[model samples]
Target: MHLSLVTSVLLTFAVFWNQIEYQQLIGSWQLTHFEGMEKIVNSSQYQNASAAEKAGMDARINYRLENTVYQFEEGDLLKFTDLENQTVVQKEAKIEIKEGNMLLIHEERGDRLAKIVEFSDDKMVLQPISKNSVSGKLIFERIKK
Candidate 1:
């Protein structure tokens, strides 16, 4: 009986601690850098692409890295806002944490899973694990209120 009680207490503490850790992610985060674009641009596929195709990819990456803000709100709400236009591009996203450290973002467009590579009070790095078009570490810094 004593061992069972100890186990239950430990489990409760673990769940509580996990909640506190996840709460750290609830805020606005600005994309500071993207590590995968360089690999994409330097790939042979990109090397042989037409000028227009290469330019388009470059434009898209620039838009994502420079103009995107990811907001993780309470109640599992997620938003992707464009900094340039000051508009929310995706307002219907829902967030979930699975496998302890994997962040699952569900959206109408698609569901994406990213491994939480590193997380702290003011910074986070996510390594994309889903089959998204983009592959690389997304580095973000918390936006101060």
Candidate 2:
């Protein structure tokens, strides 16, 4: 009985903790790094790649370019900015927590499950699953309250 009570309390605590963490994401975040694409683009392997492969890689990299910012609004609306094209795309998404460490973002584009590698008030590191099932790391810093 004692162990059961302790387990119940722990579950409750975790729920509250996750609520706070989820709320923190309801703000602006700017992309600071994309190690996955950057490493491939800068490495010697890129030089040997065929033109088509290069183009495909470039297109994927384009979506996660530096200076990109994402604003998560209160009503599940996400405003994403692409600095290179100076374009802003808005989509409604539902954020769901999967297994405590992953966040599932369901939107018009598709459902994306991102692993939270590191998260704090000022910074976040997420690894989102790409179209080809490849995972890409994205680092971001808070830009607005």
* TM-score of each prediction: 0.65, 0.63
lDDT of 2 at 68: 78
Task: In model 1, state the lDDT of residue 31.
Answer: 94
TM-score of 2: 0.63
Leading candidate by TM-score: 1
| Ten-residue stretch with the least lDDT total in model 1 | 82-91
lDDT of 2 at 127: 85
lDDT of 2 at 86: 48
- Give the winner by lDDT: 1
Candidate 1 lands at a TM-score of 0.65
Which residue segments of model 1 deviate by more than 4 Å?
1-20, 40-60, 82-88, 131-134
Q: lDDT (CA) for every model shown?
A: 0.80, 0.75
User: lDDT at 51 for candidate 1?
Assistant: 98
Residues 1-145, model 1: lDDT tens digits: 9999999999988765654345778899999888877788889989999999999888777877777788888888888865436443556588888755788888776887888877889988888885547577989999999
lDDT of 1: 0.80
